[model samples]
Target: MGLLHRFANPGRFLRLAARLQPWTNALALVLTGWGLIWGLFFAPADWQQGDAVRIMYVHVPAAWLASAGYVALAVCSVLSLVWRHPLADLAAAEIGPVGAAVTAVCLASGSLWGKPMWGAWWVWDARLTSVLVLFFLYVGHIALLRAFDEPQRGYRAGAILALVGAIDLPIIKFSVQWWNTLHQPDSITLTGAPTMSTSMLWPLLISALGFSFGFAAIVLARLRAAVMEQRLRVLLLSRGNAAAGAPS
Candidate 1:
């Protein structure tokens, strides 16, 4: 209730986003640039895997966001459904393609890394299979949201689908553990501490945070555009109505 009221007004959201956007964009740029330089140049190569291990810097973060973005989409869907906030629906719709792109990057990079390390381009492993399903879910959401002539109906249906597809998120997380797979287990989780050394893990963390904020900034920019477009549509419709009512 309180949350809904705070952001319900487009004016308020626009102001808040305007202020936050610069900070987020700056932070994303700095962190991503530093992370990439450190990962690609300074970080020690794997003794066994050698240069191929560099791919993890990008692959791991993309895989993480592929699932995390959907969680965000689901939350926005719930807000749109229960509170009927127009901005929430717009944000969710705008976020779908970004999430899909990240998922594809994760899969493509993973395949490239696999060829040298695992002796094949791809295998129907549990983790790989579930991530593929996640990709399809993103595709379905985008398709369903644009399927109807009435935009609101399409958004409503898409929200329902987003919420339902969220169930697969947990499955994707546990797929590697639940099955004996070739993919390495999670490095960041397993015990009280991360499995990697500070030198390796720090850059990965920075890069992941950068990617998250980058996604947010893009979504906010798209949402702002959507709001303005809607406003223009309303203005045109009102003018058309007035002209039709006048003596001709």
Candidate 2:
């Protein structure tokens, strides 16, 4: 309750976000720039995939964030529903479209990389199918939230759906292990060292980190905008009510 009360003030959040945004944005730009150059130019190409492997620089980070962003949305949704934190709903709402966009980029780029390597634009492989489902889940969440006339009711419903859909996240992660698929196996894991050389792995890691922070920064900005808009609407409504009630 205390925490919620403290953060509920938009001015506080705006101040914190303003301070953090520049640092996060700068880090994202530097890391992304270095990662792309290192991955595309310096890292040795796969013996079989050749230069096509460079696509991973973009595809891998996008795919990772697609899942990560949804998890964030679900968590924020839960917070909003349970604690009724003012910014939580706004954060979740702002994050959904961004997550969906990342998922779309992952799929589109994967298909582009697949056409030459896999001989088709897409295969109904388990990983691909699960990712597709994840994409649909994002779309459904967005549609459901907007469906209701009352914004709070819509947010509540969307939050529930987001929580439910999060169960698919682990399934997507394990799809490669559970079923035969065209998508390659995970390159990095907690149990063992990454399969790639330092030269290649470092850039990929940098890019992943960069993309993650970039997503966070964008979400913060969007959430701030949402909060301001809501405040403006409330102010306008109050003004209207006051005008209607004034002495004749």
- Pairs of residues at least 3 apart in sequence or in different chains that clash in candidate 1: none
For model 1, how does the per-residue alpha-carbon lDDT over 56-101 read when each residue is reduced to its tens digit? 8889889999999999899989988998876888888888999999
Best by lDDT: 2
CA-lDDT, candidates in order: 0.88, 0.90
Off by over 4 Å in 2: 1-5
**TM-score for each candidate, following the candidate numbering:** 0.95, 0.95
Candidate 1 wrong stretches, greater than 4 Å: none
Model 1 whole-model lDDT (C-alpha atoms): 0.88
Residue pairs with colliding backbones in model 2 are none
Per-residue error for 39 in candidate 2, Å, reads 1.0
Cα lDDT tens digits for candidate 2, 83-157: 888888888889999999999999998998999899999989888889999999999989988999998998999
